[model samples]
Target: MDVPADDDPFEAQRERASNPMRRLFDEYGRERSGTFAVGVAASVFARVLDLLPPLMLGIAVDAIFLNESEFSLPLVPDRWLPTDPETQFWLVVGIVLFSFLGGAVLHWFRNWGWNRFAQYVQHAIRTDTYDAMQRLNMTFFADKQTGEMMSVLSNDVNRLERFLNDGLNSAFRLGVMVVGIAALLFWMNWQLAIVALLPVPLIALFTYQFVKTIQPKYADVRSTVGQVNSRLENNLGGIQVIKTSNTESYEADRVEEVSGDYFDANWGAIETRIKFFPGLRVLAGLGFALTFTIGGLWVFRGEGPWLFTGTLRPGEFVTFILYSQRFIWPMAQFGQIINMYQRAYASAARVFGLMDEDAGIEERPDAAELVVDDGRVDYDDVTFGYGDETILDGVSFTAEGGDTVALVGPTGAGKSTALKLLLRMYDVDDGAIRVDGQDVRDVTLASLRDTIGYVSQETFLFYGTVRENITYGAFEASDEDVVAAAKAAEAHEFVTNLPDGYDTMVGERGVKLSGGQRQRLAIARAMLRDPDILILDEATSDVDTETEMLIQRSLDRLTADRTTFVIAHRLSTVKDADQIVVLDDGEVVERGSHEDLLATDGLYASLWSVQAGEIDDLPAEFVERATDRGARAETDGATTDQ
Candidate 1:
């Protein structure tokens, strides 16, 4: 597995060590400030109200049944409010009921606030991440797998939502309960409160250790998830090949390998998590048991442990026991909070890291739209490479508006590289490509791409209706326009014969259609765009001879009065081209008309003679050179496989 240059999962631990919440809120939370504030306030108030029932129980135990009414409250005399035993009992009951009702109402508002916050943030982050991803340079995508990116957008983004909803909600609720109960215990009886709090440090230490151990494991979990997803996606995408090669068992074993890795990684994290929560429970149970033993001794045995006297009251003891019991979950939930945070922390690094990657290709700030009266394209001293290996060096050419310029070359001779440079798919390492005398780099990307139409050797069609795929780039095209373009590309007859005509669904990558049919649809798409400059890269290679003749006629009319650059291996396709440019080793070796190149009896002449099935008529050296070139192509392919 090659890690993307933009992402390092091992460093996720270091990144997660930073404040993920702060980074997330800074990037995505500020805009929802008002909503978030409301949600937090609601959670706080709800938790506070929830604590009232327990306190009311203590009040009832002390005042109504014991006939003591010993607790004090400011600004109210005992006689002013229910002083009779029966009235006092009913009053406490009413207050408890009211508190429950109030807590319920606040819980509803809290849920609304948090859910809305979570949903909005989820939608925003996913969309923003996708937008940022689409704007990145093609090289970034070339280095990263589609499934790996999808995992970030879908799984990783969903994880953030889970943390924001469940983790944050539980954290606030538990914090309020622990703090409010602690305060009440100390105020009631500081002597026993100290005993109750003895386990706090131990729990904290345990939780800290758990977090430290689990952080790296969670990061591994996230990485393994991406790998598993990548493997599944790769298998599905290449299912056709797998079936054709009868390698289903091999692919299944590959899937099992990645799936097992995911299972092992996830199980390790689960094992640590399982150990952590139970350990926390034991610590909490110990604290509860200790408080019960000492408090019970002070009351029952008439002796406080290492204290003045057994001054502990029955009512206060009940309150202490209830508060101690209540402390159990928050303590255990602390481990859960840490668990969710670590998972979210790992996910955030990959998501934000992708967002931080810079797009290498961008137009100048003051770039202007290209206005083309004539789509004259010029590639001047262009040089480019993938890393240190140059694909095209010092390559230059001119295609006057409306002229048909055919590019013919051997496999590694840079025909496709030159066209890609014209499209600005990559920036040239040296010199420039200009359209209508304006430097392409100085023009807005949208405008530069809008003027050129491309039909690739491998045509891609979306899984949609035929009409939709044809008008993908020109979405506003009416039925008449779509029909005209289809007719012009000689695709109308076969398309209308389909089960649903133009409305028929072309399955993924147009797998429902034959190769020739796909190519014709691609030609129709370019025709619909009506670009001033047209690029055809082996456009007719997939079609039969009759269909090729029909398409050639349509292309002849489509290329009229437009800047056309054609790349073809079949010499017949370029026979009528106004000028022919032959490339060898990334440099131009010949330039002339077809007949003139044939007259020169050079490389083009030998290739033309070979294509004409006149290999015996070619010179012995030319035949030897052709055979050597074929051998080199095979050797290069093998090297690439290695």
Candidate 2:
């Protein structure tokens, strides 16, 4: 099978981005760009105004204790201010109250903008990821587990939202505080500012080292989360099987084993994260202590005429002390910001990576819709494979309009592969499959599938009422039409006898019903579709003999006016096919009617004899092949013995 890049959903993109997290933001954040800018601007203004209160307090101390001789405003000259000391104190107090009020208003705007932006991005990513997954070919799904995909869509995507809302907002808030405080401190006294900022470079280097070490550990943690989810999902889905096998303890041990692996992986990352914060606090503490000691000595000097000729007034020293105390938190918050970004980066790789995968089966831009008048299908020298192992080679066959063709072969003989080709589930490596002279690959996938109805050996029904399951493909079908299809499939009588009749809920995969009942509902679903081409891959194989006969009657009606292909193991099911094509090892080994091939005494004859319990009359070579195929099918759990 030609797998998609999403076989590993975290595969690198073709045009590798230097920063994937930034790319993700640009892609989904374009719609909310105005709101995002507003949020950031509000946070910046709030931090700037928040610094005003400390400056006002320092000025108030100078006016009250040192009097008008030492008190002097830079912007407001002595002529504009009140001469009384008490009036000056009240004027400064009012300005401080106004600053606090402005900060509160800006903080409100910041919360609204960031919260709305986070919600919109989360919804967009989840929907876009699901849409991409649905467009991929079946081979991609076969290579992945359901739980692994769910983990990316649910858990990983949610992580991105948390970072954008809380982490990114906090980062910007702390950034503004750090920058604003630094400028104010330097203006107060450059010498004291140097002491306060001395530890900043060291903190940055320490955070850089922590980020580099924790990144790979977080990647490992994400991978282990997927494994644990897969194991739990698999066990829950097959709980009935485990109970019947009496392996509850065995399954419990397996769950514990994966859970323990997740714990160890998470704990390893936790150890690295826990060590980072305390070390950051120590650096922040050093900056605080150094600034306090140096500024106190300068305050005692009264003018700093002796200490390097840089004079620091007592009021300015008070301002520097208050501002330096506020700087420590932003430095510590910077470390947390790095931790959140690393987590968001890993999740972005998986979510955006899935969205970047190429579709294996893509339609040409100019491909036209399929026009099926009589629904004739032809496989002209078709050859295909999964990886390097060929499944169908030089396989040629034809089914004329309104003809029934049956395919019979042993296990893994490419019987089902041939039917799937006509549906364009997997394109042929060579040659072509056509509907009414139009190549399948050349036609629109939707129109081609719309004209064909398929019922597989493994019947699957969704978790819904009988009416919903029957009308799944034909969503706009009327109640009368649904009843008509159910009656034709011989399912109406039993469906009406259930607890809620047609409204009864079928558990997941129709587990609430027996195999035969689920099989009948599947046929009803196909019958309601009413397509021009029908493919039945052992459609009645799951039912009992009596139910099979009932379904066979319905199949005859459904295939009366359509080109139908049947894949069967029981020779009795396809004895009346217009053409019978027998395959062995991906090649068309026998081609003829039932009676003509039986008279030829070839491989088809031997298979028919074995199913009919006439093995003694088979030739040595034919009997030996049949015996080998039967033993292999039994070991592989393939139901080909019948």
TM-score leader = 1
**Candidate 2 Cα errors over 4 Å, as ranges:** 1-18, 64-93, 300-315, 623-642
Per-residue lDDT of 503-574 in model 2, one digit per residue for the tens?
Answer: 999989999998888888888899999999999999877678998998888888888889999999888999
Instruction: Give all candidate RMSDs, comma-separated.
Output: 3.1, 3.8
State the displacement of the C-alpha of residue 135, model 1, in Å, after optimal TM-score superposition: 1.5
TM-score of each: 0.93, 0.91
**Which stretches of candidate 1 lie above 4 Å from their native place?**
1-20, 69-80, 308-310, 616-642
Residue 311 lDDT, candidate 1, scale 0-100:
74
Q: How well is each residue in 246-347 modelled by candidate 1, as lDDT tens digits? A: 999999999998888778878888999999999999999998899999999887865676663547767778888988788766878889988999898888
For candidate 1, report its TM-score: 0.93
lDDT of each: 0.84, 0.85
In candidate 1 the C-alpha lDDT for residue 61 amounts to: 79
